[model samples]
Target chain A: MARFKNKNKKAPVRPVKNQPSVDHITGQKIPKSFVFSRGKLPGPLRDLELDLRKLMLPHTALKLKEKKRNKLKDFLNVAGPMGVTHFLMISNPKSIPHLRVARTPQGPTITFEIHEYALAADIARSQARPSCPKELFSNSPLIVLSGFGSGGQHLKLTTIMFQNIFPAIDINTVKLSSCRRIVLLNYNNETKLIDFRHYFIRLQPIGVSQRIRKFVQKHEVPDLRNLQDVSDFVTKVNRASTKSAVRLQEIGPRMTLRLVKIEEGLCSGAVIFSEFGKEADDAHEEEDHED
Target chain B: MAAELQTLEAAAAPASRKRKPKHKKSKNPSKRAKQKASPMAAAKPRQPSKKMKKLFRKRAREYHSDEEDDGDVEREEEPSSGDEEDFDVRDDGSGGSEGDDEEDGRGAQHGITRFVGGCRAFRVAFMKIMKKHLPDDPLGPILSAHKKLVAEKLAEDDAEHKKKGETKKEKQLAAENGHIKPANFLDAKEKFLIGVATKGVVKLFNAVSKAQNAQIGLNPSKSKDTKGVESKIVTCFFSFIHFVVLAKRRKQAFFSELQKKNTQVSNSRNDEKGNVTGWAPLCDSYMLTSSKLKDWDKMAEPAAVVGQEHESSESSDE
Candidate 1:
């Protein structure tokens, strides 16, 4: 009876250890001392009170609610001229990676970022072009001539024609760049310096895309302009920048793109005209519907 | 044949057929005939005086001149002038005077031959030869067809030389005189030009903290009213919805919006987004940016749906 009474009073259920809410994918806990229990938090995690201590320049940030009129895309575009690489939007443990390098020879160079959410985003964005006014117009060093014709048969025809030009170009001769070492933590952190011509063909101002667009309508990936276009572009670096064939990064809130660094490229004005032709046709159709 | 005979009659026989010049012999031909007979070896073999010897030599020379020139002329005129009175006759018709006319004719012929071979008449002679060989062949109408072409080629050469001779100083002077300005390269034309001329200042602090938090007003997109210089044609090239995600992070920091707000940190560390969120007056007023973030802010001029881009921007002709 005394033993039973002692069992009932057993020390008020103390947990053997803390199950610390670790990063979702990385089976490890964020160090216990990671959270700085100081000053004032932004009410709660949902309030997103930023740890200004971690920020490179706390004074440079703008508040979201106060600047609701500002589009995230335009903001990052402005940041672009600043050479931003990693625009860490949120630390949602759920965010998955688009492409995950499991392990380098030394083991996974970037592992934790490969979560379900990031993977989905990466997949979705991979299938799409990322820049506006289209990235092709910015005098890119690497140009990719993917026959993005309307249908399968159209694509096949384009590919065959492209193949003829491709061989003469010696695309294999294009030098692929290895690394984009971002020495400066700020600009390099957000911007990716790439060997744009390494993978893409530096085309004449007149190219297959222009020719295709000349005859038929080709749509641009929607809503493409960003702040990166207007700002004062400064080359913040020490050594010569390594040119990567493709660069993947987030510009604004959730905008992502697979940017092929075209050295000299421009989208087809003819394509734009064709697109207008289609638009006019669509408008007529809409008018008929209205009637 | 009859019509052609009539045409020939009407064509009027060549002037050459009407005025052939006649040849006549003088003392030289007579002397030459006598000399051929060995008459110059004086029949009387006397011991001649000095004066007599000189007179004999003169007579011998005269006799030789007539013999040589007259015989040559007669031989040339024999076959071609078989008909009577067709050739040009000296009024005297005497061997001596006619011989003088014959000498004049030979001198005229020599002058013409020499002149024809010079630069001015070389082409004329060549053309004459071509006409004789192919009288009616239009393709070989070298004399008639080549003149215009030759003149044009000469003119072009002259113009080219003149251009080559022009000095660099003249070109510079023309430029300074504003003969031509360089082509305008502005994409948006006038609007872009205006953008370069305009400027603006952006403040970061929420008015209360910095300068009494005066809310910077925005002009309506469709308003025709003049905007402040600060808000002009500003082109924003935002690649992604960067500020939105930052906002989201900021939101995450705010404990009030979460179910677990109680457990959230109390750090109200406001990382200023600098003046990034302020309104920029674009010179074009057409500068646009787009984003796919649905719940976040939309670019005013050219925002689009998740899957669809704005039609105008979709036509990115620029």
Candidate 2:
């Protein structure tokens, strides 16, 4: 009887708790995103996609599988269950890179032609001392959009789309500690290009002597052979009152994007605006003629 | 047989002579004129008049008899072949230069050159390919299926919510009292624009709050600052009053006592600096003699820590 009881024994099951998708304080659906490429991307663009996924962070699927045969509807179908709010799809057709940012289910999709891009590795290689801690991507980046206020309805829609793409921070509830990264989108009205830059926010403590700070932070003892007394090290140079110095260090996959088209649906719809105005209209007319 | 042959030859001779003059006349004109005449000659047999048909039949009979007269046939074929060769060479040379000129002109007009075929041919080819690949709309079925699934899911969720009376009540309460206003009334574009504006406002508010916090510290109330200032003033006034009350005698005694203590401390510090038996030299000797500090140069190597760990363990064993 004891042998039979031992054979039939099973491990106790643990209760699973579901994480809330809605913010309790604001009662708003927390925006999560999926960054994927529709078509096959080249090595550099694939790395850029990975960097973008990192930029989205915590809320985004870091390792989302995308197949060449998968269409927009496949992603849309999956998005409903996963609670994915936005889709960032990159495609390189005719050797021209295009990024489509769309809202899930229904969308006013914005298509941008990537004129130029530099991978994060390139940015890091350029710096003397590059610092990208693993914890840096634990929190999503704060977005600072500039020069998007004055524009047409398409521009306004673009501004809104960019704003909502990232999780909105409630000022009262946001922690200073978690604000570690910033994504700056600077729109050039003259050139009609948007400069996208990602940076790490660093705060240096002021009012401490360099030698003392180095010793405390790194635990490396300074050379005492040159000094007559330890007091000389501390009192040699006295700076002003202590305050935190805020600085932004570039940690990038920089992109120069030109808005090409705005569509009404998710990757398909009525063209609300287009960069190639007359040519696009002519092409549309030709298509209509053919139809 | 010789007499019959002579009769056939005599008949073919006049036809060949007459055709030779006509061919020579055509060749004497420009290449464009020859090209035009050749196509017209080829088309003539398709819809020939009665007189033209009779002439063609006579030419055909002459052609059959001329086959036996190889010399006449060769003579007739040579000129036509030579004309064709000349026409081909000219066409190629002229076409090459014309294509170059057209390319240059179009290249200047448009920054990009279309390496594909002419516009009409390209359009026709593209249409043919599209028709072959896409007989019907491929996306329609996929979109409709997705829509159906989404509708079913929504209906199921509504049914489930109705079954859960508490959840339904909570949802109703949330809809009524939630801070986030429903954006269903606005179109996609308007919603986007409003979202942008709201985000901008929130960013501005957050920036202002951060700046305010940095400037005046974390306290939000103005009354607290005023209260702090009043307390500081009261303390200063009381201190001043106390100082006035004990002014003359206490001030003199405090000054003398402070001067005595300063002199004593200076004397001790001077004595300590001058003394050879002090702890400073001992500390310097200890730091200099320490094996860890002695091997500092060697310790700076990449694998120095591993070496140190090995040495330390060996030393411990010894």
Candidate 3:
């Protein structure tokens, strides 16, 4: 009778517990992220958000539910308990896709205006054969930041923010097997644009004949119809290198981002830098006048 | 000094005619006496009066406003020359350059020198509103909590590593005794399943490519290869059907095996439930009561109709 009566009652709400996972070797708190869209996103932008979530794998909420009524404060409240270190929000307010990467709670948010983007599926369709294994997204991709070092103060901050968004790997203790993907951010000084590329890391052995390698890896029996002997397959002429090489094959949701604004707080606060704002130049002029 | 005074008098001559001659003559002696008392004021460059300073500031503000409107350059220059004539009438000496230097300094202080437009103006206004609402140091608590979490995690990791270090000596001793940890290997069933899945995928891909080639060969432009293409297509179609049937059979076999195992477990439960049959009687009684309730409405309607007919016959007899 009690069980039946209790069935109509609401379940008790559970309080969120703050328990951050730590790295075993480095003793650093593993950075986790939340990738969600704030406003209405186009279908392609939604897919881009999913790709970004996949890029921050193993520690991100890949299936986070967000409603129109939910505000940034709600995410911040939840982020505190979940130990979310960063938030990547995509919002397309007036047909312009803006991506905001902010450190959780109190932040130096970097907003990027996406000039162009290509989804992973589009990249795959253009390729002859796209290799995407199930384990490709099991670990977070390694971030390779380039051309950001020689820029201004805001660019330096952007470089640091991107570097810390993913988990930091101590080279001496890091395992090579865990690195299956790489996210490269290449900045072009001339155009003032950042080229974002996600690539799959492939390792191929050197000095291996193509026919024998295919047989070994794919278990495919090569045709020996024109060969004098089976030994001919093994002794096929191939370029031999002393060391095995690592190859990077782009498996991408590629993006070209122009840094539009940098705010002192999460999506708010004083504008530290802006590409389109006259205050940016005005501020520089003010500094010069002061000097 | 006498030559500079003559030049000053020449610049102020037009102003004396505009004003009364007697008033200009009365004020000139007092100005000369003040300049004579402070010879350094005369030696130094002439400074614009407060009125002239205000006019220069206004001209600068107008220039910025015109720039904001993207006004004509000639229009802006025309206003500047008229203001300079007003400056000549108001001061005894030419102070146009000094007024400009002072206005530049004041403009920088007031943030009015630069032409702020578009998003920069919005940003400035946004920061002002944000400052009004947000606390001066709102990040303190959030930052402290983050730091504390990192410190706690580091402490926990240190303890874990200490424990691991304690176990390392025993592991080394065991290794010395030739009882090292065994290498991890995949289970045979898992390995075989992986191999089977990979080979199956490769075969399907090859079959698909062969079909595509056959399709290309069957194009109307390649009429000479039609016969060979037809045969290849037929073989590929048959192989595809074969693979589908094999997959279907495998799925059926797996589900049937699961069903068999489930029924065996249920039958064992039935064999043990001979003494506990309370549920059967309870279910039978519940079904009987439900059926009786379902028939109650029909049974009551006939009774009410018979009563109504009797009542009608009684009234007719009366």
Candidate 4:
């Protein structure tokens, strides 16, 4: 009777041991604990946050909802970039879910969690290198994430990471990187010096994607000027991004979702608005029927 | 007795008529002899010059063997492979003049010969002999007919040259300018010459014998496109497709002729084709590469050979 009672009782939540640490929701591995805790924001980070707030404060009044504004502020505090006007945060954990932000001081910035995905596991899975060494760590060198907007914007974010030296080392004794020796910390803290100065920090220009997205969004009924732009719209559909757009439609309360059904390579189904809730469901049912 | 005397007189009458003509010819026999002698004197044969005699002797010695080889039962079965190459050289008579003309201008006159053993005339003669001896050979007869036409054309050209009294200098000049027509001259009117232009300068070549005279035809012109500035030059080579088309047509004609003849002839022809097709492309590519070499810069100074000592020293340093 005691065993049955104990079985009915739920187990207490505890962190798993020895496994590489990663965020459950974002799948992004938490980096070395350098970001100061809430009540203990250090001088440099405080100064950086203050500078960002000062830089962003004069641009425009914060017109976002109170909840969204608080979230954005918290994110900005962590990632100290200036002039962040809008952002789309991905919540799923299949790949590293990230915030696709525009109107940043450094142009477009994709802030995401750094995951401890392995390059060796990827190479092994691909069977690319026949004689791959057993000692090779399973941490990936590249982290690619993407999301879409109903505003016809395709955001592709690619970040490269490795077991390299953390650049923001806050120590006078470890000023000269070559002079210092690497002391391995347990299982997960092994690192070597890699210069990620030029490539990693800089943003690769989105060019056509950003421009076309802005153009289409600005003119809701897109009257594309050229054949190239028209072709781009027709052919270039980011499948990964469609989920975010669908999510966006589901979330926005006031905005009307104009769902167009595509069937048999033609728009044969009805044009349903979000106001008529059953019609949207009907259109989806028709799509499922076609499938 | 009167009837028999009339019959005898009738027979004697025709005999008497024949005797009367002989009596008349005997009176003017010297006049008839003088008439025949005078005609003979009018067409006096000129004695051949020492050089001409020597050339004839040399030709007899060299080309005579080729003629004898045609009749030779053993040689007829398996022809000398080298002679077919010579036949190709000789068929294009312009090839001879081209070498001479080039040698005159360039002065590197080492390997220039006007006559090879298996010329068109010689081949025709050889074919004639082969046809007479080897009657069963269907190819021999047909090829001989074509060669005979070629020989006739050559003979006509020789006659025309004699009539015009074209001097050696004029002939040489004509050859140098590529004005001389090929030996297998189709018509008196049509002349086909290929011109290769590089950077603004043009070099001409006889279409037929250009491959055979690669040394002359391939060498880049000494004349400059401009006086000072070096121009970016482009050169176009003669398309081997024309030769391929011609060969296809010839093959079709030969096959058609073989169909008319026995299957044995067709089998032998196919065997001959198999032998030729294997090496023909290799020979053509060699000819093309050799002819396409227009780097005349090497003529000024012989390219210095890097010696073993220098190579060893360079390798040791490395």
Candidate 5:
């Protein structure tokens, strides 16, 4: 009877394959597979940490290749209306059996898994429902990446990687609007090892006044309406808006691995894809419907 | 198209005269004479037709007005505005002076009539004014035009009320009858006239309500100022146009719009016109026709409903 009790206790323990480092900002674990080389990375590759640190700032502009930018545009055309906040990238073959690196018109691509998470605590608070501060939740994450090459082999490694990257998100919830997105981005070996980057794509929710302010700050225009000045202010404003949209389109597909706070969660939100050419239309579809 | 051709001829004739100076500069006297004659030849014959149409319209009005004596055009106001405005665009300009003369005649006419029913008294006072102002107007053509419109409006109202059941139809049909229905002086007639005459309805309503009180003997002699009389005249004149002129115009527009939609004007023709020749008799003819149609429809529907119920009950028993 004593021997049977000892065997039961022994069955529950899990063995560790590899340990990961903790992220300084989020205080979350960083998987070991994220590091490219054995021990320290050689030469200027060491500066990648500084580059990534700089990129993590909330207001930093995104940089992507032309082919990747086009790929990102296609993904955003479908999923941009979802108002998604966080994107989780899974590269480890252990966790995702179907993920593979494949060739496409854009270039070499990788199929991986991404789990979308919403901040339920914040959502509950916004909804005026009483909720515990520490509680965080998500719906069932979806398999969404598309590419080819050895995918299922790293299931164990990828599982740990997903655990380290994402928060302790519970899946049991009745009102989750977060959806699975199948997206493609240009791939390279360097991207496979250190794929996560932070993106700050300016979205449609940003009002015209805010955009005008951003334009003023960028061009150092003291007065918005300049009659004597050679540059037509109206044309400049339009050009600036179009440029921002192009930037957003390019930024949409570049994969990001940054950890953001998930506090508010709601099933219904205001994310109309139609362009509001008339002021009446904007009045009918209010801005902050997610609340 | 005719107006456009006349305008082009008038422009061309002037252009040729101006070109004569240029012809002189070019030393071309024969060319100048030829250009002058060509435009003048085209313009002279076309000018009289426009004038003749105006003359014809005036004669038609005088002839019709001379023939009719009935002044019950109060109910015709709603559907006449659309056509009258278009048909009398030129006449309205000259008719402005005539309207003023009619206004004075209307005030004199209102002083004599003493009807008791609040709305009836108002309608009588209005008809007296319209008659005194437009004495030549037979009031027959407009009255018939209005009857046609009322028939169509009643048809639409019936169709709409049918789905809601019989009680609504009874109430609406009761409202449609002009005689037994009590005074609703501040009604659609007042509303449509007020919209056409002035931008504000509230001011008109207040003035009219005050005048109505005075007419009803609430404060009779106290409200007899020239200002009161002028306001009353204005209301009566607008009410005449509202019921008589405006309704004719609106009926014209209604029929045109219906034709555009490919729906026939259901009340344009009446069976009672076989013996009726003049406008007043035609108005009587229309009233008889529409009332008969309404009575027939009302009687036929209930009998059919009873027959259906009896049939269904018998089938169930079998």
Candidate 6:
């Protein structure tokens, strides 16, 4: 019996801790809704951080994509009459896999570990955020590069972009009395639209206004006078806004961003994506929601 | 088609001149702030009748005369310079004299009577003044002709009003007021309609768009089958699909069906004697008809709803 007890003690003691468990891959809250969310390490990429490994999986990537789509649909669904605030979105461009670029009040910033993927982070830092769709934008951070470490930690970074420029858009809720656009969101949020470089390609204020008016007319609505009365309501953006537009400064452990605008009524935005540890606020949120 | 033609003719006539319903309100000589019960504050202080002015001044020499002493009755004074100023903002600017004289002439000749509903005593006072001011004689025949011309001109003015109304409709559709801007065929079908309220897609709610959008489900079952039948039955007033089928015989059948709907108008055939047209009652109804068959057709109900909207649009265009 003493020999058996000695054998039990002799076996290598596995490390144990009293801290709360976390989703190792996302560094996000894994709620009771999750059936099996624990991360699996890959043979070759295992040495990379767990967050880096998470990006490599087809399933997780798909899940993240679905997560965004559902959020978009949910937002469009709920944001109709009642209002929404702090609504978050994660957009995936066809070009990048690991990048979780988000449009926010701050300029566009990237999130990634510095040491683990030194070469990839360095290259990303060198590239400038593109600026054609926008006369100004933010990109390429060095701190995001600095944060990358080979240790198996899950890190997330959110980059904020898209400044709402509909002047006084937040001051009042608009009711489209004539048209049947059942999915109209608050004007402030509409300016938060994504990938709109395609929508304005052949756009004209008069023509677009006419088409929308024609829809009202077809509905047998008697008149569309108020909108017509203000012919100068020509642009979606308030080029005259006074607020600052966001610009990207640095990326690494955290993103440093600033906003500047040329006109008085508009705002520029920034986005920073940083990976938080699993036992952080998000986990607390998950716990709070669980009960 | 004939009913539509009459609406067109009515719309095409020049501005008609209707005798303006001269419900002329007499002026007030007293200049007082408007009280709800007030007519025009009494007019221009009455130039003070010679004897009244003498006594009023004599009373005032004691140093004060309350406004009540003006002896200004709340009478419906004849339309005067002051009354011109009181006319509504769409002022004809002819001043009170012209508007009143025209009113007096027309009212006296046509035996026009305007009934005032508010303030019984005030209205009674107004009638006394109306009878007193009524023109002593009708204006000469030339005046009558001129007045008739004006009334006809006013009626025709409706056509002009509608012409401006068409352009106004486009603006109004942009604006959203209540005048039923004339409609056209393109407006009969809208591109986007509310689909299922839960589904954000118009394809679910908008029958028209649903029928048109191909990437969605195959055309609704009924719409697919009915594509070959040639008629304008428009069966699916509430269906979630819209398909236009083109078969000619069906249109002829539809006309026959419509003919059956208006039996009296369709049945009447009057036989007129050589020169004297006798009042032979059609269908011998108590709502005796002396009007021609064409006029009876003009009053047809289906034609009124189905064609009036189109008639207004076509007439406005012409």
**Leading candidate by DockQ:** 2
Candidate 1: true contacts recovered, fraction = 0.00
DockQ agreement of candidate 5 with the native complex? 0.00
List CA RMSD, all candidates.
38.0, 27.3, 32.4, 46.6, 47.6, 35.4
Please provide, for model 4 over A1-291, each residue's C-alpha lDDT reduced to its tens digit, 9 standing for 90 to 100. Answer: 354457766777667334333434445443321111122222332332232222222222222222422443464553433322333232212222111222222323222221211121222243322232212112211111111111221111111111211222222211111211111111111221111100011111122254434433342334455657545653464222211110000000000011122122111233221223666547444433332
Q: A-chain TM-score in candidate 2?
A: 0.84
lDDT of each: 0.27, 0.60, 0.61, 0.29, 0.30, 0.27
TM-score of 1: 0.14
Clashing pairs in 4: A29-A115, A117-A140, A118-A138, A118-A139, A118-A140, A119-A139, A119-A140
Q: Write the per-residue lDDT of candidate 1 for residues B125-170, one digit (tens) a residue.
A: 4345546755664334444445678667777988888886675555
Query: What's the ranking of the predictions by TM-score, best on top?
Result: 2, 3, 5, 6, 1, 4
TM-score of each: 0.14, 0.45, 0.43, 0.12, 0.16, 0.16
Candidate 4 residues lying further than 4 Å off, grouped into runs, are A1-71, A81-90, A93-120, A128-291, B1-318
Across residues B225-313, which tens digit of lDDT does each residue of candidate 3 receive? 23333344345546645866999999977975575475442332222232266322224464455422324335434443343455546
Candidate 3 structure, TM-score to reference: 0.43
| Two-chain DockQ for model 3 | 0.02
| Candidate 6 displacement at residue B184 in angstroms | 57
Higher-scoring candidate on DockQ, 2 or 5: 2
Q: Give the DockQ (2 decimals) of all models.
A: 0.01, 0.02, 0.02, 0.01, 0.00, 0.02
C-alpha displacement of B317 in model 4, angstroms? 50
**Model 6 regions lying over 4 Å from their true place:** A1-144, A147-291, B1-92, B95-97, B113-318
Task: Give the clashing residue pairs of candidate 3, or none.
Answer: none
* Model 3 residue A166 CA deviation in Å: 0.9
Q: Candidate 2: deviation at residue B89, Å?
A: 63
Please give the range of 10 consecutive residues that has the lowest summed lDDT in model 5 chain A: A243-252
